[model samples]
Each structure stands twice: as C-alpha cells, then as structure tokens.
Target: MAKAFASAGDLTEKKISFTEVGEGLYAFTAEGDPNSGVIIGDDSVMIVEAQATPRLANKVIECVRSVTDKPISHVVLTHYHAVRVLGASAFGANQIIMSDAARSMVMERGQEDWDSEFQRFPRLFEGHESIPGLTYPTTTFSDSMTVFLGSRRVDIKQIGRAHTAGDSVVWVPDQQTMFTGDIVEYHSACYCGDGHYEEWGATLDAVKSYDPQSIAPGRGDALVGREMVDAAIANTRDFVDSTYNAVKPVAARGGSLKDAWDAVREACDPKFADYAIYEHCLPFNVARAYDEARGIAHPRIWTAQLDLDMWEALQG
Candidate 1:
C-alpha cells in the first residue's frame, strides 16, 4: 500500500523534552520533531528556531519560563522554512534575525512553503490560524553577527549552505556549544527538498571544525558530549551522502524520477528506515537530488499541488 501523504498520518503527539546541553543552554525537543534551542545569557535570552505556530511556540516559552524569567529578547532563525519561522510573532522578541539569503527566500517562497507544509504536516501546525503571516526577519546579516545578552555572547554565522541557502549556526563560544539548525540532524531525516546536496558535506565539515562540546541539533536528542556530537554529525553526513549518491547515478543514466526514488529507497532504507520523518522526506529528497544531478543548482519552490503531484507520481 502507498504511504500516507507526507506527515498527514503522523497525528500522534510526541513527548517533549527540555534538555540542558550546557550551562544555561537548553534544547526543546519533541521526540524527532523539529527542535528549538534556548540560550540563556546573563540578562535576557535568545531563541534558536521558532516552532510552527504560536501555540507551539508557547510550549517553548513555557520551558523557557521554567528555567529563567529572562525575557526572550532575540530570535535567530536558522533558515526560512515556514515551520521554523512562522511562529516569530509569539516570541515578542525585539529582534527577529535571519541571514540575508534566508530573508530572500522568505520573499521568494515563504507563502508557498507555508501552504505546502501545512498540508504536509498537520500536526506541527496545531494552531496554524494563529500565525500572523509570512515571517520576515527584522535584521539580516550577510555572513556573521554577534549579539550580546548582557555579558553573554552569542555568535550567529552563515557557515555554509546545507539545509537551505541561508543556513545559520548559533555558536556560544563560552560553552563551545552550537545550535545547528537543520544543517545537522541526529536520527531524523534531513529534508533535502530545499537542500544543497553538493554543498552540504562541506558545510558539515565547517560545523565539525568548531568542535562543539555540545550541539542542539535540528531534531532528535540534544547532544551533550563530543562523542555524541561527533556521532550525530557523522550520521547526518552519511544520510546526505547516501541519498544524493543513490540518485546521481539514476539521473546520470537519464532515468525517471521513479527510478531515482527506487534507487534512493534501496540505498537509504536499510540504514535510515527507522529515522523520524524518513518516509515523509524521501520523495522530496529524491526529487531534488535528481534535479541536482541533472545540473539544477537551485531547488525549485514546492507548492501544495506540486507536493501532491510528486507524491502521486513517486508513490502512487
């Protein structure tokens, strides 16, 4: 039988865990769902990724309130995916930040992404109606910028393109902890629908160079040691390599998208079958990889209808 479209069938709520990866640093993880990072400075706080909606963002707020009452002063969005940015309004942060490239994506395809993802993962958007509109960053930097929460320093930098063109990693130099947005996932699948497969490994290498003692990844558990942090980075690299390498040959041979899908499934399933969102991400990953293999450097925007069409073509 065909699989349920995207994550539509994944309605069961996951257990939420608020893990402290470092001193005053927390990772808000809900099983393998999208995770958010909390960095507590000497005075206020900085949030890594906003949840999908205001209701969901409130959950993160609750976790933040439990630990410290420092006002959430800044929100740094790692990329422009709707699930990551739409909840910006709830933070009431004075500064909502993103990379310049990420802001361009928000202007280019934010609404399409919102519509597409809402139809794809209903559970994430529990309070979709509450999202004010497309989220735009109040401040954008080209490469790197540092923000100070009182005496604490948080560095936000656009290391390289991996998950999205404007991927940013939040670095707390004092703790040697990094909040790597979708660029590095633990056991969860990397949604390559808007990814740069060729550039992703290099970006991972840059992330590795930091030698973070702790890493709050995009999904899965909060990594608290060099051993676990290295493991997650290696696993994420393998997942990207496996998916792209599988599709490249198919596209090189002038095969169909279905052929690429089958190739990717054969290459990835044995290793990543148990990964969270693996099924939901497979078709889109294969589709993008196929396009990239055929010399498409930039990924095409995904609309709600394109999602259904591609799913039907691949899994129907």
Candidate 2:
C-alpha cells in the first residue's frame, strides 16, 4: 500500500484553453483537467459541466463573462459525479438540468461520492469548503430534453449508460457540436469505477451516430473536426474495451483483484500507460470490470473507504 492513493501528489495547475469550436459554442479545457462547455444563445448562455466547487466554478464564470455578459440561464449536469455537478450553485442559473437517473444516483450516493472523489483527487477539489452540498437538478428528463435559448436549440439526451447509468450529452444541431460528459474522453483515462461497460460501448456508438463536427469531451482537449471526433470515440472505445477484456478472463478464472490488476497492466500499459490519470484510474477501472465480468449488473456504490481499500489491495 506504499502510495496506493497518491492522487494528492498531483497538484500542479494546468494550462487552460478557451477555444471556440462552433459559432457560439466554446470549450474550456485545462490540459487534462475536467472541461466545461459553453453555448451562447441569442438571449442567454448555458454551461455544460460545473467545476468541483463554487470557487472553482467562478473561474469558469470569469471566462464566460469575458465573452458575453448574458446571464447564465442554465447549468447542465452531464452526469452525477461530484466534481462535475457540485459546482452548480456558482452559476446562479435559473435551471439546473440532468437526467432522471443522475438525480437518483445523487439521492443515493452523492454524499459518499463527494467524499470519495475528494479523497481520490484532492487537487481537483481544491476549494472543498465552497461546495454547498449535493446539487439537485431543478429539471430532470428521462431520455432526452431540449431547451431553447431564443431561436437556438440545445438538445440534451441520455446517450445510454457508459461512465454512469445517467450518462448524458448536450447536442447543438445547428453547430453540430456535442458536449459529452465522460462518455467520450480523448487521450485521457476514462474512470470506470461506476461505469457500465457493455452499455457504455453502445453509448459510444450512439455518440458516433450523431457524426458531430465538434465535440467538447469530458476531459482532454476539444475535438473540433470529423477526424479528431472519430479519434476520440475510437480512443475511448479502446480504453473501455481493453480494460474489460483484460479483467474479464481473469475474473472468470476466480482471479484476485491483484491478478486483474496485473492483466490490466499487461493489456493497457503498452497502449495507454502514458495517458492522464492512468496510474490513478487503473485499480478502480479493473475493480468494476471484474464485477461486471462476474455478472454484476449495477456498479456497486463506491465510498471513500472502498476507494482506499481497493487501491491498497491492487496497487502493491
């Protein structure tokens, strides 16, 4: 367990980039940090993902104010992760939107998740005291819902289950821009602690069906072209498939979590060893893969203790 949970060691600030992917669609990417998407309509603006805390979210608000003084009318929660949803209060938006399943997860494990994630990635939760509690959605949709900012339309759809059971993405038909939460990460390790692997693959295919011209992925840089979009999808699929493939057989053989860890290292090290968060994410990813491979339908809720126990058991 020598440095099993060394997430706090990564405290360096990333270089933030605010790039306009479409006419009024923008992506605020901070190296490999969590990303936020912006859409400025004729009347108001909608922020795709809220940062970890209200204080951190203000950084995004500052960037938003630099371009347009429009009131942030909507705050969209792409999923139920605390890092992504807990900062909703900062926007002071009229509506907070998320999938119904996301809301359920929040009701069930939001507090535990907040503590678990904060423990796992302290750097990401720098301003922990600023978070006001779990962010409850003002609006929840079952499958898909569309909100209009004047004549511009923003479609929010539950693109099946991948990263979580409530995985959702915001799509702009006119700009052909899609803001996928963690459903599609580019060159970043997709955290599968609470993921649904089989359903996640179909969800990625659902993302491909849109053929989006621009994609503001959950992490990493924004994908602004067809080729890059395709690459992001492919990279995400590969990460997901490789993780499950590596762990499934070991799990079927009644192997230990450490055994699954070794299989994952052998399978994913050559291809994605250098990816951001690979070291931090490997244990949790294989834990879930092991569960799913053994016919576990739903992801077991992960508490702070579970996170540490799993890491110590697998990390050597």
Candidate 3:
C-alpha cells in the first residue's frame, strides 16, 4: 500500500488511470480514490459513478473525450455515496440513474454523508463550492433497468445489499464485463464503514454467478482475465469478512467500542496492512461493525464531528 500522504507538503494531484476493459467499456480509477466507469455505445455514452466534485469529474470527462465525441446521456450511480455521486451535475447528463433504495438513502442521509466525506477526504473534493447540491436520480428502478446505447445493451441491476442498501452493478453482456461499484475492490482497502458485512459477502457470491470475463472494480486497476476478476472479488470478500468477524466477538461480549476497534486491528492489521487507507478506515469500520453486531441494521449517520471523535477515540 502506498502512503496517501507521505510528507507534509506532498500536494500533487492524483493521476487518474483509465483502462479499456472491453471494446467500448473503460474503467477510470485514481489512487485509491473514487472510481468511475464508461460505456460507449453507437449514439451516446453512459457513465457510472461521478467523483466528489465537478473539477474532479472533468478529468474523467477528458478521458472520455479521448475516445468519442458522443454526448454522455446517462450517469448511473451504483449507490449514494457522496464521493461517488455528487459530481453528477458536471457531466451535464440527461438522465441520472440509481436504485430506488439509493435514492431513499440520499434523501435520508445525503447531507450528513456529504459533510462527513468532505471532512474525511478534502483532497478528493477539489473545487468543493462547485458542487451544486446532493445528486438525485432522474431515473430510478426497483430491481433492474436495461438501457440501449444504439444496439448495445447496458443492464444495471440492484444485485444485493453490500456496500450500502442500494448497491448496484452495471453489466455489459455484449462485452461480458461488469462494473462493480464498491462491492468489488482491486488491491485497495475496502471502505466498510457504511457496509453490511454479512450481506456483502453474499452479494459477492451473487456477483460471481455472472461469471464476467472482465471486471472494473470501484478502485484500483481493472481486472482483465477471468482469473483476475474472481481474485478481485474474493479479495474484497475476505477483507469485509475479516473486518466484520474480527470485531464481532468483542462487540458481542459487551465490550467497549474502543475494545472492539482494538480487536479488529489486532486481527486485520497483519493481513491488510498494505492496503490504501487501512489505518484511516479501521476505526469507522469497527464502529459500524459494532453497531451492526448489536442489531443496528442501518448504519448510523456519520457527521464531521462524529468522524473526528471516532478517529481520536480509536487511533489517538
């Protein structure tokens, strides 16, 4: 794992990496930051997951410009994470799509999540003032929706509850490629702070059933071969399972949240020590797991103050 900020004055903007995973499908990833996907059809394009702000999204748009001049007609949000969906306005997309549950989450905790993520990752939110407001889906679905880009079929499905209650995957059956939001991460830390561990693992199983030849994960390099795709999914599952299970016993014993955090660290640090943001995400992950273990089905609202409080309580 590379240190996100190794020195005090390291202020270089992160470089975005885009890889063509299929004929017209591209995966846009940054240095363990939020990722976006692109599917170009004959007449139009569909983008998946916007960055934190318009300034950040333009970098992705520039990448798309390199490929085709077709208008980006649809922006599909895999879930309602502030870092992933707030940049929708920048694209000037005609239809912003999302799962019904994701739209609800946005209405429920969008403001709180926006504030919380801004605090956690200020670098990702460049030109923050340009963010008009919380992004809402112009089009939403209960289970799945299929859109055609000319003759190409792009199927967006709400697979299962993993990263959030409304986690979704964009499957391009023609190319046999799937863009898994945060449900799958490649060589990057899984941000399980707002995740449902048990359901997340099961969701990975559901994703595996697709047998995709290539996969674009939420972060890191795109998986090309079938073996690499499976490996990425498996690694994501292992990370979630270890984080949740490590904290579960302590949480069940009626131990303090701090104790549960320590238990998770002891169990996970050795295995996931090299992943990006491992240290930063642990406390929040433990806190969420603790709450879940205690029967909290929904993740609690995470405010900016709450983020610092938990960080200090667990890491200070």
Candidate that scores best on lDDT: 1
C-alpha-based local distance difference test score of model 2 = 0.91
Q: Model 1, range 192-216, lDDT digits (tens) per residue? A: 9999999999999999999999999
Decoy 2 TM-score against native:
0.98
- Tens-place lDDT digits, model 2, residues 1-316: 3664837678888888898999989999997889999999999999999989887788898888889999999999989998898888989999999999999999999999998989987888887887888899999999999999999999999979999999899999999999999999989999999999988889999999998999999999989999999999999999999999999889888998789989999999999988888888888899899999999988999999888888778775
- Tens-digit lDDT string for candidate 3 (200-289): 988999999999999989988889989999899889988998888887888778899988888888888888888866777777788889
| Per-prediction TM-score to the true structure, in the order listed | 0.99, 0.98, 0.96
Candidate 1, clashing residue pairs? Answer: none
Better of 1 and 3 by lDDT: 1
* Prediction 1 global C-alpha lDDT: 0.95
Runs in model 2 lying further than 4 Å from the true structure: 4-6
TM-score-better candidate, 2 vs 3: 2
Q: Candidate 1: where is the Cα deviation over 4 Å?
A: none
lDDT of each: 0.95, 0.91, 0.88
C-alpha lDDT of residue 310 in model 3: 78
lDDT for position 104 in model 2: 96
